[model samples]
Target: MEVKHERVKQCLEAMMDSGQLSVGERLPSEILMAKEFGVSRETFRAAVKMLEQEGRLLVKHGVGTFVIQPLPMIPSSLERLSSIGAMIRTAQLDQGESRIKFTKEGCSPEAASALGIKLGDPVVNMERVHTANGEPVAFSMNTIPQEIAGDAFDHDEFQGKLLQFFEKRLGRKIVTADSEICVPLHIDRHCQRLLLHPQTTVLMLKQVHYDEANRPVLFSRDYLRNDVFTFNIRRTT
Candidate 1:
């Protein structure tokens, strides 16, 4: 009986990871879930109770069980450079997506300074929302030199790491980055809508990537959903 209950728990967890069961979505009734899993009602109840104790599900007395919003903590090493996609994959999250909201040719003073370009130099700007397991986790704005990012850059083709696109087009790898993290009081309307937690504080990451020759290649500003992602750093002497 214990073994059967454990299997039920594992199956449900996998469903959540694969986005088949989304956050805040209600689960089927105990009888249906038990039948679907080919388990007895007692075993199914044991599994559900375990998940509830783990804070993965919320059960109401008369209502059904629902998946709890997960707080996925992503550990970031200060000594290394990593992309949001890489972090999501490292956490073994299923179905990561970066949906491009828009792309334009523009130049911002801050982007110019970070990329070490003239004030009016053209830059390709892109805005995207990063999702893990079908839940919005971060919103990002990326800027790249226009010469490196040609006019053929397609927003729809962007899925994983943005740096991979640059590396493929420019034939130069990003060697390092200067990044800073801060807690911001508010985010834009787009991010608020996508994240579905408008009033929550956000963690902002400002980063500038450099190529092998130490030339700044990309500048990015990322707003992270604080409730969903917890960033941590490790220190050693």
Candidate 2:
């Protein structure tokens, strides 16, 4: 049942992507669309409901459904695990030039607690900036135990994708993360990196990523420009 609804939802998204359905245009009747997709009305409706919750469709009680213009920001799903670079690519936005700097340092008290490492343990400190359409949208700092990241890790090959580097290069699978989200009253340090005004709103996500064996492998803090990024989560009772 879930698979059928997801398939229909993907078809609807493809229609919008191909320009067959334009913003402000009403979708076809549920019965008609269900027939076209060879699915039951319940399944089609479920898919439509999913899209509506995702802010893609406007559904009226008695009137027809209308396509909504997607918000002009990168959308990140809290329920899914993804790298910053992956999020930008999934949004179908043209990526601008980005930069990364790597430094070797002893673990901070905070990093040590999060990564379950002793203070003063060797770690790799990575600072990265992510840009979209020529504007900086996010700044991030990640700390990894030197043993996990390996002394011979190649910065040129990393390119700021920690998840990919862990799985592909290091042969370690990152399966989950524990994240805390917050809004800061002041983020002068992050603002300078994102090239935003001092007063601009920002969302910060502090996370500890765990490997398949439930061992913490990465500790990161990501500062996202509120104007350029939207984070969403789906909750069920």
| Top candidate by lDDT | 2
Clashing pairs in 1: none
C-alpha local distance difference test of each model: 0.79, 0.85
> Which tens-of-lDDT digit does each residue in 1-237 have in candidate 2?
559999999999999988999999999899999999999999999999999988899999799999998765435778888877777776677777677888998999999999999999999988888888887888888899999888545546675467877888777799999999977556468755664665557888999999999999999999887766678885557
- For each candidate in turn, the TM-score is 0.61, 0.65
Per-residue C-alpha lDDT of model 1 across residues 89-201, encoded as one tens digit per residue:
65667646667764565688899999989887887788887788888777888898888777646546555567777687667699899989876654466446444655556
RMSD each, Å? 15.2, 7.1
- Give the least accurate 10-residue stretch of model 1, judged by summed lDDT: 186-195
Q: Evaluate model 2: give its TM-score.
A: 0.65
lDDT of 1 at 73: 43
